[model samples]
Target chain A: MDSQSIATTPEELDRSVLPHAHEHPAFLRHHFEDVGQQREAASFGMWVFLLTEVMFFGGLFCAYLIFRNWYHPAFVAGSNTLDITLGTTNTAVLICSSFTMAMAVYSAEIRRRGQLILFLVLTIVLGSAFLGIKAVEYHQKYVDHHIPGLDFSIQEFVHPSNPKAIPLAPDMAEKTQLYFFLYFAMTGMHALHMIIGIALLFIMVARASKGAYTEGHVIPVENFGLYWHFVDIVWIFLFPLLYLISRYR
Target chain B: MTEKTQETHQDAEVHVVKPPVYLAIFLALLALTALTTGISFIDLGVFNAVIALAIACFKASLVVLFFMHLHYSSRLLKLTVAAGIFTFLLLISLTMTDYISRAWGMF
Candidate 1:
């Protein structure tokens, strides 16, 4: 019943040619049979990328687990030094971003362009808020000379400003540097992911404005939602491991 | 009476059904997050890591099942994803065995 079946004569074929000649976006490829196939491929690809991210973070976690067991006391002492309030706040912020991201994807699916844009912007705002808080926490650690580098100082641990502060063994205190190193490495990597996710979100917003996903081709939005949630899950793990692990002790 | 008819029947049978509401999943995730955070403040000794990871795993499963629509995906797709995760776990476990055994002086 379509025009393809009726395109027998040359004149008919010529008349149908101009409309069929309209090209999709340059980013869209030909190998995919349709928009659905393209979307599925994109989502699957993002999932695989996230799987690699897991392995990447898995290395840091393995290091933490091994070293935590080896130098349990030092690691626990180092964990105690972390500001739990900041980490928990960041976790909550990331969860809010994930919620917004899900809403963005849902809005796209339901063909609510304005809602999709609003949610995407909200997710970006929440993500930036997380990074801003993280920067402040890291800066506080720096001012306290807690950075695990050549400039790291153990004077505070050796001779505390408060008499009730636990005095660490000099050697154990040195080992705390390893803990902070792991902390910076792990959380820094996570923050890097957040930056990339936010950048991608901006790109998605631009594409969404062009009415790309408005017609119900919402695969990009959906895939980005997965990425956002995965990043959130990473932070959820990192928060407790770094901040809340030995707070009571 | 032919192969095409049999294939159509199988396709119908294998089709996935979507959930009526995603709000339940969202609420569950929020609850799990709060629960995990609250429990982390408690001194559970060695069980702390176990509990945290367990809750995280549960939350992740909920997200995958509902938000990602894995519950509605075909068997092949589900198996593929499971295989990917299984391989990652295998890598992590094998590598950790080496690292952990080093600490025990079994290296």
Candidate 2:
């Protein structure tokens, strides 16, 4: 929690704003009343940031909804091309990671240093496994010529290799590019957030190894838990919206 | 229950969520994921997408309430989250309404 104490210049932090002066820990910032107030304020700020993230991704979702409704067959064909096995596995992996992250926050609260380190490591591994599977899917898409730049082609949807898949007319197949575009845009944005989160996890690991958060200071762990769960929540929506599009006949 | 609530009232800083709570939420999420996937395999016409979205919303709520610990948080934080969702709905409804009402009378 106090790892960021170095982030702000000392002179700028007004100790007066934090009124609970009776036996406070060093990690409790001078600008907060107590650890409770500090934790609440930090979480409130985190939720605000998450709210911004909502609207940010909302634009992409809005586009997906309109385009999907407009081109139902193209959407269906395009969705069927997705590897359900990998998508389901990734969903399970992310859910498991969210579980581990919640445990990590619990470990931090209880001041269990070893469990904290272990859970954080597990989260990093599970998160990385998700990215590895996602990378495999992206590479497969690239090989299938589904990347939506000028190199993009609709042969897959136009003449699907899978007999079970609905075939799209060439023009409608071109519309499949729109579907793929939204797919990459949405999932790619999600992967970018995962990459950033993994990077942060590494930093947290290094700091936690040094007993940074095990000393009755859990704001950082708690706040980061909020963030990790938020990423999972986004995937919770994405799994159905992207992967399960009228998948039946 | 009264004693537990009183303890929390005094020590508001550290709220330790039991591991069982987390485990239960995790299982619920996994079960919902399975349900959504299984349901998608049936052709329910227009109901399919609606049901899928509804399930997704339910799973997201679990994550928000338990995993994110918003249930234990303050009212202002809850309102903030609600406002975000409201604005998102506003965006979706307004856009969908425009598109849906575009060529109204001809039908």
Candidate 3:
């Protein structure tokens, strides 16, 4: 009975005279005091990295704000050229992926290996769906000759393709290129981040299948969840700004 | 009982958000997305952009607080995020002052 009760104890007391001996799990780094401390340090580091990402994306946002204000009419014309249906669909897809990622982190915390794998797979699928829709939108833009510096035509903006469409002067129509330039810059950067994230998700899924995160080492999954959600937040703002601007016109 | 209490103590340090809360936040995000899109189809003049940005900001807050676990994080981490936001605002506002003043009274 004594042996069974002692075996049930969370930790085994070592005979070493040192205070820290045998108290921490193997996963705890030598530099850390305990598992809790290690987790805190890891999370703090991830937050710092995410803050840098914020500033990196912030620069693009600042430029976009200035250009949009300077050329409001062109900004409206450029924004209207985008397909709202696809934009909204992509937004919902990204949000779904974020939800799956959050669930994956939860699964790891609860040590459910199957659920973790399932959620991760779901997230990857949703992320790919977002990119696929993005590709379609880009293809449409290519066909419409909206791409800046490559076969861009200001004819449509200057001539008002639709009878009710408001026409812009040739000089102002030229500014539409700046709007599209910012559009490509912002969304292209966002897509590049998503591509990197999807690549990392593949590596994580491989490791997770082997039970890497379900064994009390959930920091990696949790940190990646933060990243996935951060990407989604970027799109949340992008959707309304790039697609919804002057849609009522 | 002792082991259970110890486990609880460890869990208290880093709160594990449950599935229900995640689902709630997810639904709320979807609903808000739809709301923003629908509202955009109505002409609100400058308020259209204002309302859209307001909704986007709220949605971002939901993700940051819950998905990023900032709400349950230590004070130090929360302060770090706050500082980042403050710097971002400062960058935008400071630059705008120069731009707006350069064209002062020209419009």
Candidate 4:
């Protein structure tokens, strides 16, 4: 190595150093005038990405609302079959993940590499926990034959395990299949987002290990934090709408 | 370069005190989440939807203001985001209008 290319101390690599400097090729973008501009543009771009996601999920929500109103009785019965405990737990887990993701961004800002990594890992773990619980719930639905395909069985609703249980008419029970279809579609989409977020967290962890964000360019971490929180927010809406409505009935 | 030009350029990159406010907004978000969930168990009839949506809007506002840093951003960026959401809302509302009005015809 040339003497002019000596390694600089961490303290010497402060925020005043232009983030657009050629130290990291991956961090620079041709369209951006500087690192700040690059970061701002990237964050704005992410918001636009999230807007599209909202619209994507928004379609499912519209379908759900329509079917829900058209067959209110069946929708209520369908909601009652969901295990509220599991759904509520998943909601809490997702919120905790959002909290940790926010802390990860804050740690990056404060230049605490260890804390940033810790929170990022915590966020990933919490997210996985949510998906795990959701899997179990889905499995239970499968065993009960509530899955919304042609294989779905209406026996559970017509022949209630408890004599006092609400006996849905065959037509209403069939409409329940529509409710389950929307449920799986919406929650499945949300879970897909969680998986993608976890994958990105892995990439962020690798970059963070190289002190990318710790060097004061924390905007990547921050922008990713926003995306994670937006995903969490979508689930927050989904949980109540899909799993909690008329659950006590 | 003229002194006025230099001053204006310097002001462009001014580092505002945004971090603390962002943290406070984060705390507000946590509180709002808890509040919304707690209220959901109550029998609010049709008002539950209104309340839930209201709280969600409040939470979304906090995220947009603090985490997304819209409060510190330029007017152009703000308009860009607003336009996107407005367009989305328009789509949702118009589509729902068609579906919701169909209910009366079915009766």
Question: What would the per-residue lDDT of candidate 1 be over residues A112-225, giving only the tens digit for each residue?
Answer: 778888989999999999999999999989998899885999887776564645777898778889999999999998999999999999987876666656564566677778
lDDT (0 to 1) per candidate: 0.73, 0.84, 0.84, 0.74
Q: Write the per-residue lDDT of candidate 4 for residues B1-107, one digit (tens) a residue.
A: 46774554443342433346656765676677677767767878877767877877777777666655576675656887788879878987897788778768532
Please provide, for model 3 over A1-249, each residue's C-alpha lDDT reduced to its tens digit, 9 standing for 90 to 100. Answer: 001211111232222223564654445566765567667777888888888888888888888888888888888888888889899999999999999999999999998889998999999999999999999999998998999999999988998666756799999999999998989988999999899898988988877777667767787888889889999999998899999867735
lDDT of 1 by residue, B10-100 (tens): 5323222222345677667778777877887787887887888788788778777766667766454577679778987898799888776
Docking class of 3: medium
Ranking of all predicted structures according to DockQ, beginning with the best and ending with the worst? 3, 2, 1, 4
lDDT of 2 by residue, A66-89 (tens): 888888888888888788889989
- lDDT of candidate 3 at residue B36, scale 0 to 100: 98
Better of 2 and 4 by TM-score: 2
Where does candidate 3 stray beyond 4 Å?
A1-23, B1-12, B105-107
Off by over 4 Å in 1: A1-29, A159-166, B1-22, B105-107
Q: Which pairs in model 3 have colliding backbones? A: none
Q: Ten-residue segment with the worst summed lDDT in candidate 2 chain B?
A: B5-14
Candidate closest to the true structure, highest DockQ: 3
Could you tell me the lDDT of residue A87 within candidate 3? 94
Classify candidate 4 by CAPRI docking class: acceptable
Candidate 3 chain B lowest-lDDT run of ten: B3-12
Specify the poorest-scoring 10-residue window by lDDT in model 1 chain A: A1-10
- Measured against the true structure, the TM-scores of the candidates, in listed sequence, are 0.83, 0.90, 0.90, 0.82
